[model samples]
Target: MSTDTALQVHSLKQSVDALSEKVDRNHSDLLAAVGKKKKNKDEGDENEERGNWGSKIDFFLSCLGYAVGLGNVWRFPYLCYRNGGGAFFIPYTIMLGLVGIPIFFLELSLGQFTSSGPATCWKFAQLFRGIGLGMVIVSSLVAVYYNMIIGWAFYYLFASFTSKLPWSECGDWSSAYCLDRLPLMENCTMRNWTATVNGTCLNGNGTLMALYNETLSKETMGIKRKLPSEEYLNNVVLGSGFSDGIGDLGPVRWQLVLCLLLAWIFVAATLSKGVKSSGKVVYVTATFPYIVLIILLIRGVLLDGYQKGIEFYITPNLDRLYDARVWKDAAVQIFFSLSASWGGLIALSSYNKFHNDAFRDALLVSLGNCLTSLFAGFVIFSYLGFLSTDLNMPIEDVAEKGPTLTFVVYPFAVTKMPISPLWAILFFIMLVTLGVDSEFVLVETVTTSIMDMFPQTRKYKTFTVVTCCAVFFLLGLTLTTNGGLYMLDLMDTYAGGWNVLVISVCECIAISLVYGVRRFLNDIECMIGRKVCGFIPWVIIKYWWAACWVFITPFAVTCVMVFSWYDYTRLDGYPLWADALGWLMTFVVILGIFIPAIIYLCITPGTCGQKLRILTNPLVEWGPALVKHRRLVARYVPNYVVDPWGKEDQNGIAPSDIAVEMQKQDAPGYTPSPEYYAQKM
Candidate 1:
């Protein structure tokens, strides 16, 4: 009885197993047929559905333009001097290695492999989609204020056409206390006149008041004449727009409004056709600035004070590197200079041809950005050095920072040069060029996010581009008003500064912690090859990318972020509410990121535990853009799981070599034969 029962039970189990296998095979077969049909259909739609950069060079130039922007030409040099001069490079390069290239590579590889924008790419973890949203928001805010600065530059360029640079001497609008020739060194730093009067309120004691008056009377050349350049910026061009406190949003400066209008028009025209127009535009906009920079550099070094200014620029105060603020500045500078967490990098890289070598491009572009900054430092400080000598001032006192460094001080110094107006035109033009080029990428990032989130938007791409421009124009109008400078300060401080740090931190956590760095590395390995030898490995040269993602980047960003919060410096000069408004701009972006997470939890199918798993899971749809990409990925990342989309061998496995073995490998300078274009292209 027992033998018969055992035999019957065993036979029943075998029958069940066979039926189950047949069902599974049928399901796989069904999926295969469906995939084949979709593949055929996608081929027909691929032309319009997928757009790649016209050539690798175009992409490289576009990246160069975006990363080597005003931040490099204007912000970086100032930050270098203001922080610790040559010592700034220690923290800067360290942060660049820790956070810059890793994040840059992360953005580029994410876009190229997925062929998507930041908003849609977060499908890897639905909960992390807010990152893309936050990025877009940050990009949008930056686009607004950033263009405003360009408007200012444009104004200066137009004003430079005067027979003699108006800023060369005091005009009728100059203050009674104005000085035609600004003092050298410490003298110029001392408020020319009014600060001494105002100092009385702070120093009611007769002793302090007498000391201030004695210093001013002796050092101020016995007159309170405004520096002609300062007067020009404060009165002639700006038209006393900053006259009142930031309490009132005053009338729009018509000249600035026109300049802003012109800037927007240029951006709209450039980006209307999307990457095609921007790519071609970058060829000029990106390279022209370097030409001007070089011209100025040559002009600058040949001048009198070049050595002194450059000395101040590169002279290391090693002690300053130990300060937390210096470290924070380095991190923030790297973030802004490289355009990280703004979505622009992701958006720009999204247009690349599938299987493009994004890894090499990332390293090259990131290093190029740093080199460009150092070059810019020389170009800038050389002039400041000359200016310092001209004014009999020390480099520290006369080497202005930020907008003052760019617009007021630089223009003032140029006035002392031969053919001042010509140099002025070139300098302002360079500023405008850098400004407009960077603006292109920022707006493109916003545009790409919208197009991806709602694919239907592509049908009205022209309309959408116009709408974004119009919207940004309207928002930027506030910056065109008298209080616009304050508005720009507020937005720039909030949007691109600390908030970007938070966004960077979140990205590292999302990919490395939530989406899985291993998964991302597999994706990267597919588009670009495995880590190779040479000066190839950055820093330690092995698993450097992975180390950045998991350890270095997050830890570095966190240290800077925590230090920032510890001191929490707000953009000074405004009221408490102005600072509050800036904080609001930051939080609203951060809060928006959580919205997607909430939506994911509600709509995701599964038990609470299952939903949590999905929150932490990578979608199967997330992977290389096509089979070529998958094959490349398979070569290096062993045992990687990918959705082959039914491309399988007889053994029922996606053979590592089957997909790409026959394809020519990418060599030192070797390029893939263009399936749809010239091989080199």
Candidate 2:
């Protein structure tokens, strides 16, 4: 308890601190020296380690192509009509604000800032690495059945080139129930056909006279006939005429096998060189569908009964807004349609130049996706209207989703058009284009994540792509069997389901709580600039940051997940084993989330709290990908705890001028000069 003893202890502590500082300084200097030497040695041989889009336009088009996919056409229109017509947009746009644009921007910013794919991008918070794995799992499963859909589109496209569309008339593939044209039974005597000795109409339906006349005293719903188009799809396309269920899968259909092979071939061809090839390919694949959609819309509007279809599509039923299911549908549609959390957005945006303005790209692609979905509603419903009048069915009856809408409803509608074959060709072509881009982009997402994790694999890009495509094609052959339609439906129902919702929720938690929202914003600011250009852009960027902090996106996605589970329906007619299998698939994909976290925690050397803190913190390497931008980050945001430059303040105090410096950047369209960073550094 002596003053001399206290003074001695303080002096010894100061000496220890000085020694630690000296050691740290020497370690940093040694690293800098080694880095400089390596740089000098590799200056001539170093190529750009990662690829970029040929231009900003290539990036935009690739995003556009992937965002505006087949779902916009087949799924959106039906959802709109089903969820109270135009009234659906209220929830749709709301969901877009809460979930779509925010997540879209988040993924793009994550990839662009890190210059990495989904898997390796998690270097920001290693504990959440499973998010990237889960994303890849969803993308991989989706790619398999999604390519099958593309194959079906290809099958229909080739069939459309015939002098007469195959589905336009009953053929050998037609079952006993196929009706080429509905017999007019208005006069109680069916037109164009007579009751035969077998007590059936010549057109393959039970005699209307027998049903209508005999059932005069009873309530009769008529013969319940099937369309020739339906028969063609079931018998010829799916070859499922006798398929009882998934357990009844018959021999693989060689024709569809050829079509699927062709689909994979096209994907491999486009992705052979990664973004370089896909970027150029998007110029065609991305824009072609719009032309067809516009043409079809125009043609559709001019058709009879178009008003009823358009009315059914846009006629807002404000009451449906009160339904939770409608809101759930809107949220699910927006999430899937924009391809959020699917890893495609992350993969596509990861190819940008370091300083590329992902902010503008995010807005452009998000708004474009929404408008495309709305515009597609007009195109699809207009045809549904015309088909409604032609078949004497209600607009609701003709409207459908999934393969039913794409193959049966649309094909039958086209058959009723002038230049039926041409319309058929254009329609199928649009489906192919819409589907192909999404299919390959998902494949790219999977490939990008792999190559990023193992940089050495990047050199064998073509070989990697071929192997990926070949593997997917082989797996997809299961869906080419007689009962594949049932299997595809099962996969579609379970593959993504609640799994992606879990990832989205995890992403929000990781970014906001684990990684720290303010720090993430600073990192983003390092790439896109602290001051946004215009008033609206400024407001948007601010709103996005607020949304991230407020947990709006995760909360919204969580609610949707709850509603989805509440509304979950067993895959009809599939046995209990099939349902169990679907759940197993979901569990396996979800395991992608927890397994990595556990493995990461186990390997981290520390007590529980220390290990968690370390796992949550970004690696020193996490920041802008380029050297200059990283230097700017170190100079401007030097208070970040894990600065790679070793310039972090020991006292943990950020510069008081940080706010004033940002204010100085507030000038309209202000751009930093190289000298600004140079002087600061």
Candidate 3:
């Protein structure tokens, strides 16, 4: 090489090295802090720990991705329409402040305070280890069918690649009454309606109808035929009627089965390398969907009937505030949208450093979830408003919830837009990514639980992730059968619904009442480097937060749960037996709270009162996973302590502390034993 070329190369190398040195100098303390508790992979290593996020942004986005998922985009919009549009915000916001954020902050405290998964965080209340188990169980149950929802999005995504959207027209999968009248209805007036005779209806003139129903005014318009989209969903996609009930799942739909397999593979591939990879994967999974949401919002607002849709979505009817059911729905939406009572919250926080400011992090995530849901409502309702105008139907008739709103209403609306295929692909891809982000954490929650229980599995993460994917995939197969939607609806209603409320109620009671809210707050202050008592006037974060946990949350959640059960009705299609089975399934998860208590009580050597005392006390084996973590905790909040077991740590204890016993020896970075180890503590 010539001397000039060599000199240029040498100059570039020197410049790069100089820049690197500057960065190292600027971030020296940050680098030192991060490297202190780096992941350890060694034989019989007690200091073995999971890797944390590469940076704070990773954790924030990961939490955002997990909390604001499919429900935020689809379910929240429909619930707003059904509950009271603008009026729904009152109860929703009220619940958010009173019940939602408190529980959110509580879980963050419990997990970060100990650096443990949900199952292992229950040392504070040994009798309620079942609460942790219940969280994992509910998450596992929801994860099965949740993936099936993604599979449906995949099917539509592939179907959208056609020259024309397949659900655009009616054929063999349509009902006899189904009719396409977009052009024909263009010239028709409000007086023009579907006519009824003795035989059938062809373009609103029906012969098979028993009578003329249009004599009375209906909020509905152009009801002479089923929309091609609705027919495709009911007839081609779900094929719901063949099965007797949840009991008869019917034959599997091969297309959906394949899609389900693909869904599991998608999730497994995302989680195969654990958080080391997933922390980076979320960069796309979490943030890119906002781009699609923005595009849809802009396109929707510019449509022909945008004003009407926004009106139906945001206009308030104050009368709804009087209904108890509206309040119940508000609570349910908060629970569903924020992903509270799910094990994912604890599992996600368990990866944080000892002194991470989780208080600020929790506020960011919870409020971000609410804001996303609110904005998504605008995007959805705008499209529905357009559909209403185009079809000459009322806004109410165009809005729906759950799968129908997502897979049916939205997909059909996309087909009507310009460059329909492009919009369809982007919309479905957003749906898949949003759902997959949450599923990633859910799959990890299960893996984290099992790994925490059996530390050796950490070395075989790939095998464990694949095995989890396979097991959940096989379990999800029932939901891909001809009657899959019906089974999904049933599982959601039973295995998924009230069980969440039960878990939330049980957790609040255990944490606030049994574990002691003040003590919990102390632990949190230790981590966040600030007291809960803040300078927000009548609203100190710690004082109000503690009040909610101790009084407001438990009371309010109990009332809602009671109100939910007061006049519960069974699903329409299923027989009486199915309702019984649904309740039975719900009870099974709640039963987890008792199972551990029963076994522990039976095994412990103590009197009845002694057992009660021991059951309520903190376990002796609980403390920081490493001396370094403990020191960090002490350094930030010097007055705070981690003496849960009350064992001496250059200090003394008085009470008969609760004794926690687990079969597995592994914790965050230390193994527990019957006798406390001073050096480890």
Note each model's CA RMSD in angstroms.
Answer: 12.9, 12.8, 13.0
lDDT by residue for model 1 (549-617), tens: 888988889888888889876566789998888888898888877888898899989899999898776
Which stretches of model 2 miss by more than 4 angstroms? 1-47, 181-184, 187-223, 531-540, 639-681
- Please report the candidate that would top lDDT against the real structure: 2
lDDT of 3 by residue, 1-681 (tens): 999999999997876676556445435643343334332221122233665656667778888999989999878888789888899999999999888888887887677667688888887668888888888888888899899999988988898898898888777767655545322232222345444332222345532332133212122433354578877877677666466666677888888998899999988988898876888999999998899999999999999999999999999988999999999988988888888988888888887766677777788899999999999999988889898898776776678888888877787887788888888999999999999999998888899888888878888989999999899999998888877887788778887677788888888888888877776776676566554223323225678877888889988988998988895887997878878877877887888767988998898788988988888887654545655455555654435454543333443321111122333432222233423333322
lDDT of each: 0.78, 0.82, 0.77
User: What's the lDDT of the predicted structure labeled candidate 2?
Assistant: 0.82
lDDT of 1: 0.78
Worst window of 10 by summed lDDT in candidate 1: 201-210
Clashes of 3: 10
Q: What is the lDDT of candidate 3?
A: 0.77
Q: Pick the winner on lDDT between candidates 2 and 3.
A: 2
Best by TM-score: 2
With candidate 3 superimposed using the best TM-score fit, by how many Å does residue 577's alpha carbon deviate from the native?
A: 2.7
TM-score of candidate 3 to 2 decimals: 0.82
| Candidate 1: segments with Cα more than 4 A from true spot | 1-47, 181-225, 240-242, 531-542, 627-681
Ranking by lDDT: 2, 1, 3
Assess every candidate by TM-score.
0.81, 0.83, 0.82
